[model samples]
Structure formats: C-alpha cells, structure tokens
Target: MKEFMTNNDYHDIGFNGPNYTWCNNKEGLARIWERLDRIWLNSKSIMDLSNAVVKHLPRISSDHCPILLQIENKKMHNNREIRFKNMWCSYEVAKGIIAKS
Candidate 1:
C-alpha cells in the first residue's frame, strides 16, 4: 500500500468522527476494529479540491462503517475585490489611495 501510494502519487484523505471503519461485530475481547475503508487523492486532485475532507458515518446493519467526503467548492478568485482596513483610513496616504481607487 505504501509503495502503491508513492508510485501513484496518491495520499489518504483522513476521516473525522471515527477511529475505525470495520469491526468484527464481536463482544468484548473478541471484537476487533480496523480502518479498512479509505479515500485517496492525487496531487492534482488535492490541489484542485483544496478544502476537501472526509467524514465517517454511523454503521448500521453492517460491520463496516460508511465514509463521506466534504469539499469546499469555492471558485478561483481571479478578480478578487480589494479590502481596506478601517485603521488605514486614519493615514493620509490610505485616504488618497482609497479616494483614487
């Protein structure tokens, strides 16, 4: 898995709200939990989806838990608006610039 991830330039998208995804469904000492489900992304995907995240859902009628991915879909700011601080208005230069712009 390490070699595969390295070779493919893939990285794990870690989860929140759960430590493991799979369970043996046994009682006490016999029970076992493991992170069997995973989500991987390449460098390009990671860069494109900058705010991507994973979430783990509650398991029901199954030993393996479900997984979810949440991503922020913000468009690239090519023409972002300029914001001026309130304190900058105190300066003459800032007042001139603000007036000019």
Candidate 2:
C-alpha cells in the first residue's frame, strides 16, 4: 500500500461505513476480519471535487466488501479517470510497463 500510494500519487479518501469490510464469517479461533476495503484519490482531484465522498457498503454474499464513490462536482473533474487492475500487476514485467507508461 505504501509503494502504491507513493508511486501512484494517491491519497486515501477516508470512507464511512462498517468498521470491518471483510470477514471469514466464522466464530472462535477460525474467525478473521479486516478493513480490507478502501478508496483513494489523486491529490489534484480534490481541487476539482468539492464534495467527493466514499462509502464502504455493507458486506453481502461476497467475501470482499463493496465501495461507492460519488463526485459531487463533476464539472471541474476534467473527465480524468484513474484505473488499476490487479491482474496487470501479476506479471514480473508489469513494473517496467508501469514505469515506462
């Protein structure tokens, strides 16, 4: 997370929702939970979104939680969309791709 934040120039958006975003749904010593969900934004994007909000939705059937993000001031956002894919990072050559691009 540290490397990704520094390299991608992203800052946490600090969401509002359940404290734990994920869990094994078990009890006793077999149980586990974590705040695995989060939303991040570019520092420059804040200037464009005066009312940006992120919500961590309640856990459902999936093991991972859901996220909802709203940008209230779209007029100034300039249509820039940042996308990240975990699969793209699996390859060893991905570092070069990320660096070169």
Q: Name the runs in model 1 displaced over 4 angstroms.
A: 75-91, 95-101
User: Pairing residues by index, what is the TM-score of model 1?
Assistant: 0.74
- TM-scores of the models, in the order given: 0.74, 0.62
Please state the error at residue 78 of candidate 2 in Å: 26
For model 2, give the 10-residue run with minimal summed lDDT: 73-82
Candidate 1, residues 1-101, lDDT tens digits: the string is: 89989999999977797899999999999999999999999999998988998988999999988898898797777787777789988998889888887
How does candidate 2 score on lDDT?
0.80
Top-TM-score candidate index: 1
TM-score of 2: 0.62
Deviation from native of the Cα of residue 11 in model 1, angstroms: 0.4
| Model 2 CA deviation exceeding 4 Å by range | 74-101
The C-alpha local distance difference test score for the whole of candidate 1 amounts to 0.90
